[model samples]
Target: MTAFIFNNLNDMQANINRNKLFVASCLSLLVTSLSFGIRAGILGTLGTQFNLSASELASIAATAFWGFPLAVVIGGMVVDAIGMKKLLVIAFLFHLAGIVLTIFAGGFWTLFLSTLLIGIANGTVEAACNPLVATLYPDNKTTKLNHFHLWFPGGIFIGTLIVFLFEKMGIGWQIQVAIMLIPTVIYGYLFSKLDFPVTERVASGVSTAEMYKSVGTPLFVFMFICMFGTAITELFTGQWVGVLLNNVTDNAILILTITTGVMVVGRGLAEPIVHRFSPQGVLLISAILAAIGIYMMSTVTGSMLYFAALIFGIGVCYFWPTMLGFVAENIPKSGALGLNLMGGAGMFAVSIYTLFMGGFYDRLIAEKLPEGASMEAYRTAAAGTTEAAKYAEAQLTAGPDVLKATAIIPVILTVAFAGLVFYMRNKKKPQLAGA
Candidate 1:
């Protein structure tokens, strides 16, 4: 069977209703905002109670990423069998459970468990919602996707404010985590009442066998590989920024605000950029630039480090949603399952890297310490150390291997992602061959 493609304007416009699509877009933003708010927002505030060691804290921060792959995969199947609306309900419940668990969590294991569950819920939101949004507004997939993605940064913007408010009020992290539920509840209500379109792949009446067959094509595999790398970049950056900064200096809380602020501004500015470029083109630049940004970040100090983070934020801003747009643009007929599966694969990739990077970062940070040192010796070493002294010492006395390793991972992944984009650009030349 030949696959369907929406290359014409009329066909695309006929596929969606403008007003209903706006409502759906708003829902996507809500999902992005809340998802990130919990993921990154919790890190700055919640760290006080959890008191996770640098590495343990990294794992908790990255745990949500781990659930991404599995949830996306399962969500794909669920969206296909049931519907996007039902999956949203399930996602909401999981999020609620995870948040509640976070409030009562007593130890590393409980917190880890909560982070994992929350990650699962967050993954569900991406898996179900991304495809639904594309279907709701098929006429301008790339532009619309960018608009939908605005909420991710937008949510982070709101989340940052909440973090500030809580800190000012002297309220604990648990309350901050709990407070996110208000948006979730409000969005859940709105999403429940709206009627979403059937997924594009299904609505096109593409058969299951045909859809399954499409996966065997080289193009799908290429996109999947790019997705894996993209996931690692998007997740580990946000998840570990606080830990990395904390590892280097005592003013981690202040640095986190700066990093999140940079991210919000970068993402806010991305809306206009998306209109002028192809999604794949946008991703190609982001991957390469991110590599340079991370490399610079590992080496810089003082105000330079802050500037590098801003640069890094700009590089990574378009990654997550643009990757989805790549799929929606190239694989217009790929129903809910297709989008969900891509999300699942990407997330699963991130989970692996998150665990690996967390362990790697922790082990390396630990190795920086001189061997056989007692608590007394370590405390003495820490005593009277100026904030700059700690970071400078950490930068020097700390082995260069781990810092080098961090840059190497993303650089290698960026090369691979670039290759995938090249493959995708050429793949369309012989599109009928896949059939």
Candidate 2:
């Protein structure tokens, strides 16, 4: 789809309720991100409470990631045709169901299903709002998308505070998950009356076949693979923060707060950075910084971990939004399908790595344990006893092992993004055949 240039108001005026749309869109992503934060905080709780192994727990987390790609890719395909309103409503219903099911979760399978539902809802919100935001502020796609995405880390900051507060008060984790509903409901209500502009794809009258044609190219396929590494590197590490540090320090949530807080601030300041580095240049540097940050985080304890988390947070801050923004800017013909697929690939890839990292920890933890240590006995052992204590020791070592393994993803990404930067710069911007 050729971008609809709003050279004359009579041609295509974008004078909708932008402030309300922005607020609703931020809040939409807020609930999605809030689930991530709350999930991170409760990971250890779920692990011990349900006697789940590292792999089992990660499988449950994987369910959350697994549901995202389907919803995002499918919703992206029809978001323009069906209107943003229906997708937002679907998201609201799924969020409500997912939250309730999670609170009443009986065990691993129940939690998995609940989280899967919530992930679908989260994907739907992204599918709808990303295109909506781009349409609303066409002239400032990167900056506006960054601001819209700031709520992701902003919501993490809020959820982390709630987790810390609730833990201090002896409140149940269910209440923490439920607390996300406040913003969920607010966004749902705000969107009820809001009018969403058609996506640029629809406005420019791009056919579905044309959208496929653009997205099916080798360049788009390569980007799909690159986004996978980018998402897993940012997401799985963030998701595992609480579990990784729980055995190392009582201050796990504090570390989460620090990292997410840095992300929020970094995104708020992204406007000037986008001006300085351009999105592709910034992404190349981000991959480099993320690789160093994860490697430095191998300590998993000590005061320096906080500093490392800050570096990691700033490194990943621009990745998600700018990746999408690049498509909006450079691959305009791919339309909403390309945007959603990029995100879908990222989320889908993270789900796979969540499971992969879990299995890695399981293997590493086993190697460190006594030769005859029975896994089931360790699971059932009383909190202060020998097997239980050995398990605790295993967890501490596992945290760093997983981080060390995960650090390689960003190293690969550093190389891949460098190639992307080269591609973005040296090549003339390609025009759509019909444009």
> Total clashing residue pairs per candidate?
3, 1
In model 1, how large is the Cα lDDT of residue 148? 66
| Number of the predicted model whose TM-score against the real structure is largest | 2
Residue 54 in model 1: shift from native, Å? 3.3
lDDT of 1 by residue, 323-432 (tens): 77776777655556667777787767766776676667545544555565332344234436654344335534232334445566557766766676566565663222
Can you write out model 2's per-residue Cα lDDT over 1-435, one digit (the tens) per residue? 233343433144456788998999999899999999898888888887887888899999998898989899999988878988899999999998999999999899999999999999999998899988887776678888889998888888888889889999999999999898899899999999887777777666567888889898888888788899889988888888888767777787787788889889888998899989988888899999999888888874688888888888888888898888878777877988888999899999999888988888888777777997787687668988988899789878888878888899889988888888888777666543323
Q: Considering summed lDDT, which 10 consecutive residues are worst modelled in model 1?
A: 426-435
- Give me the runs in candidate 1 sitting further than 4 Å from their true place: 1-51, 247-272, 374-403, 417-435
TM-score of 1: 0.83
lDDT values of the candidates?
0.65, 0.85
Q: Which stretches of candidate 2 lie over 4 Å from their true place?
A: 1-15, 430-435
lDDT (Cα, 0-100) at 49 in candidate 1 = 54
